[model samples]
Target: MLDPLRNQSVIFDFIEKEEYFAIHAPRQTGKTTLLHELAHRLNKEGNYISVVFS
Candidate 1:
C-alpha cells in the first residue's frame, strides 16, 4: 500500500542475512502493512521461501 518507499532495502538486508527482527509500533502504525510488503518482496525474489505471521 502507498507504494512503500523506505522499508524495502532495510527489510531486504535483514532478510538477506537471515537476521531476526521485529516491527514494533502501536496498532495501525504500519507494522502489519510493512510486514506484508516485506513478505511479498521476499517471496518474489525466488530465492528465499518466506512467510509473515503478523
Candidate 2:
C-alpha cells in the first residue's frame, strides 16, 4: 500500500530531515491516502509519531 511513497526519494529525504511540509492537490487525488501511508511508515520506523486529521 505504501509502495509508491516508499519509492519517492524526495519525500523520504524530507521526512528523514524532519522538515515541515504539506501535500496539496485537487480533490480525490490520494492526498489523504499518502498521509496515512506516511504516518504508518513513520510509526514503523519508531523515530517519530505521525498523525492525520481531516
Candidate 3:
C-alpha cells in the first residue's frame, strides 16, 4: 500500500489553514484510500474530527 500522506504537503497546508477543498481523480486511483488515511491521521493527532462519507 502506498503512504497516502507522503507528498501531501499542499493538502496538509489547506487542512492546517482550515480551508475547504476537494479531491478529484479517476476511479480506482485511491481517492477514498487517501481520504481514509487522512482522516485516520487527523484523528490520531487529536486535532480535528475527520470522517469519510461515501
Candidate 4:
C-alpha cells in the first residue's frame, strides 16, 4: 500500500488555502483511502475538522 500522505503535498497547500477540491480517478485507485488518510492526519493534528462524505 502506498503512503497516502507522501505524494500529496499540493493537497496540503490546498487545505492551507481553504480551497475546495475534488478527487477524480478510476475505480479502485485509492481515492477513498487517500481521503480517509488525509482526514485522519488532519484530525490527529487537531488543527482542522476533516470529514469523509463518501
Q: Which residue pairs in candidate 3 collide?
A: none
lDDT of 2 at 1: 32
Tens-digit lDDT string for candidate 2 (1-54): 334555456677887897867666678777677777777888898988877786
Residue-level lDDT tens digits of model 4 in 2-46: 455664676888899989877777788788888888888889999
Better of 1 and 4 by lDDT: 4
TM-score of each: 0.71, 0.69, 0.78, 0.78
Expressed as tens digits, the lDDT of each residue in 1-54 for candidate 1 is 333566667767877798987666567667677778777867797887778763
**Candidate 3 per-residue C-alpha lDDT over 1-54 given as tens digits, one digit per residue, 9 for 90 to 100:** 434566366688999998988877778878788888788888998989987887
Q: Pick the candidate with the highest lDDT.
A: 4
Candidates 1 and 2 compared by TM-score, better number: 1
Regions more than 4 Å wrong, model 3: 1-3
- Positional deviation of 53 in candidate 2, in angstroms? 2.3
Clashing residue pairs, backbone N/CA/C < 3 A, model 1: none
Instruction: Give the range where candidate 2 is weakest over 10 consecutive residues by summed lDDT.
Output: 1-10
